[model samples]
Target: MSILIALKQQTDFTSTEQRIGHYILAHLNQLPTVLIKDLAAKTYTSHSAIIRLAQKLGFHGFRDFQRALTTEIVTQEQQAATVDANFPFSASDSVTTISQKMASLTINAIQTAQQQLDTTQLAPAADLLARANRIFIFSQGDSQLRARSFQNKLVKINRFALIAEEYADEAWNAANLTSKDCALIISYAGTTKIHQQFVAYFYEHKVPVIVLTGNPQSPLIDQATYHLLTVQDEYNFAKIGTFASQAAFEYVLDSLFAVMYAQDFHNHLQDLQQKQQLIQNGPLTTK
Candidate 1:
């Protein structure tokens, strides 16, 4: 679990501890450098109380707690910065400020994804995809589009791929899966109960589950055999909620497709060529 989430799960603690928890959640980026004395002063508590709170959250001491929080903060910020650099923007006063801001936001999100990715986790995930008897992708709402696109890409290489959203009973059908099959669950927040239920079911049945989500500390992450992370700026509480994150998911989907194709270059090329020829010569079109 992430340090921020660990602090949140201890809600039944004392009022001072709860205050510390709220402060840490709100200012995770600033917590690493913050002194225990300053935190206690801000929360109207003693320095020892702050230390106690950290210990209760399973940290060795305030310094250790601060270090973990700082690491997460730095990783997140670095990711955000890397995503921001990829997008093109203009400084001209004539250009619409809204357009520029959106571009910058998307760039930052991609950078965040780049920073949060774990290559070790990715290699195993790719191996699973390469060898799975069947691959099922589960997604809902806006995420379904990406799931379908991924399925299409996998099918091009003649992989037995299915999109869970395409058929309502797909998850139920997938319940019979074994370790030979793999399921990819896609969610931005990773908190959706439906997705969680499917993941839990698959996990109990000894199926391999790969999670692609923005939240690494989510309950679903624990159930996943592999996790792919995407980070997007989502501070705006109103207007087009989850838009940035969905865009980030689209980018990640494209990257995943590229990576999988590259991993099996010869097979992918032969499969694509064969499929293209079959479609061209075997199909009749009115157009």
Candidate 2:
């Protein structure tokens, strides 16, 4: 766990310890190079107070605490440098540099999405999916590509999902959905006019709409029966492509798929293994 989370969970600290904790959490960037005396003086506390606070948090002393803080800062800075949601690569970057950066950015995106995912939402979303008579996914562009991949996975698991490849197809599918069906709409922005129209249509049909989006405050949330938040720090108009958003979406979808499959864990695994064996054996020779 990060120091920030640790500090937030701590409630038994003395006033002096609280001050030290607050300072450390707020000044994580400066914690690495800061001396113990410097931090004590800055927080208006003493060395003993600093060491006590560190021990309270399970560290041996201020030195050990600072080491952990420095390590976390380094990891975060490295991820942030490469995972620029808007601008991942620079003009001066070489081909090798770009490849390394993209790999780092993709890894960071998936990790962040996992860390920030709301576990409480998982069961309910999985329940909706597992119980639905049919599933309809609405998305466009890269997000739609992820939706398609998710649909394919659901098919393999024997839970089929419907997705439209064009505007007309999307409208037709939306119009035909019933209350028994579940709708999962993927929108990074969550405020697109077209998506809003679809949401309104789904509402009219009383379809349970589950949204996967990064924007928590988006209008889509008001209409959605359930919403799964994804990572969005990498999305920007100035960015070259949709790298982080798609990764986050896929991670969430994969998690949801896993949860749904877990409902019948043995059966799902058996089905997959059977399919694999079929492929390995190939078709029988004609007589």
Per-model CA lDDT versus the true structure? 0.74, 0.81
Mark the 10 consecutive residues where model 2 has the least summed lDDT: 1-10
- Residue-level lDDT tens digits of model 2 in 89-132: 88999999999888887888887677557666777989999899
What TM-score, to 2 decimals, does candidate 2 have?
Answer: 0.71
Provide the TM-score for each candidate, comma-separated.
Answer: 0.65, 0.71
Off by over 4 Å in 1: 1-95, 235-237, 277-287
The C-alpha local distance difference test score for the whole of candidate 1 amounts to 0.74
Q: Residue 185 CA error for candidate 1 (Å)?
A: 0.6
The sequence of per-residue lDDT tens digits that candidate 1 reaches over residues 161-231 is 77866768765756757888999889877898888888888888889999998775578988889888765
Q: How close is candidate 1 to the true structure, as a TM-score?
A: 0.65
